[model samples]
Target: MAELVLDPESHFPEELGIYFWLYPYWDQVSVRGCGYMVRWGTPPLVISILKFTPLAFMVTWNAHPGFTIPHTNLCDFIVGNGAAPVDLPLGFSNIPPQRYPEAPGDEGIVLHTPLAYIAERSK
Candidate 1:
């Protein structure tokens, strides 16, 4: 299981739309056990993964209508206080930066993680 920890430095000053696209090699995968911890106030995070294929999906987040608090101060509530653990299938390898065929000009950041969660399995 791979859990996403929203680091304090990665927190956004305001509500920003974030997204992630995943394409695995497994026949099927499941994501469960999502929760949050309350600090000074509720963190803005409500993630939902829409699985389009057996090994492909898109990650999305929707802030709670009531948790509309601006992140003006660093001492205030943290961003992404609540993140879920993603259950990855077996035999997953590395995640190399391949040019997205659809968007060859697009580029993304490389995140350093202990576990190989967001990796592509060689067919």
Candidate 2:
């Protein structure tokens, strides 16, 4: 990876040790491709052994990303929240990026996660 130069116009105040705090993560496994901490889906998805293009990557669970629960628990303190079960299949895929959140009723093809979600998943 190339050197990460902090922009002079950064949003932080001029005196805090923010750069020192961020250096570890900012310098960790950054690559030409992005990294993601995804919820591994059950019924593991299979794919062809074809070689990936320069932009392709597999979202494995190493690097101690902390395994996320496969299901959602919605238990309230007083009224008791309803169960928001996470029924999503948890495996990762190297599918190409697409302009998702497609037109209404075109739900069949969509990568529902937000860009921020994709970016922050690794954190």
Candidate 3:
């Protein structure tokens, strides 16, 4: 497995007002009729270190042979106020290194979440 590192200087989305990191793994498999398919595996199975709450989060994936299988490629994370949401962000390289506008309140917390997603391929 290759390691994907996040640039500490990167900025989170203004709408979300939080920073996040993503790690992805890809596995290849062979289908009976299909020539090849990619099966995304589970996340790294580790909790994010950063502590921050989030309104909601989502994950999406794409493959070369689109829609050959009957799998839905959308994943979502919804966190309420009571519990603190993971600090990680969504999608690999989704948040680029840049500056973000400060939130309305100065005391507002800046959260950084780390999330991992896995995908599989069939050959």
Best by lDDT: 1
- Give every collision pair in model 1: none
How do all models score by TM-score? 0.23, 0.13, 0.15
Q: Could you give candidate 3's per-residue lDDT for residues 21-122 as a string of tens digits?
A: 332323311111111213334221111122123211122223233323222221223243313455433454453221111111342222232232222445
Candidate 2 per-residue lDDT over residues 18-70, each given as its tens digit: 10011111111222222322333422211111112222222222223243322
**Model 2 scores what on Cα lDDT?**
0.23
Candidate 2's C-alpha runs over 4 A off are 1-88, 94-96, 103-123
Report the lDDT of model 2 for residue 90. Answer: 25
Comparing 1 and 2 on TM-score, the stronger one: 1
lDDT of 1 at 9: 34
Q: Tell me the tens digit of each residue's lDDT in model 1 across 1-123.
A: 122334633434343333333444343333322332223355524332223232333232455655432212221233354333444332234431232211114232222223313233467
The reply for model 3, stretches above 4 Å from the true place, is 1-76, 79-89, 102-123
- Which candidate number has the best TM-score? 1
> Superposing every Cα of model 2 onto the true structure, what RMSD results?
18.9
Order of models, best lDDT first: 1, 3, 2
How should the candidates be ordered by TM-score, best one leading?
1, 3, 2
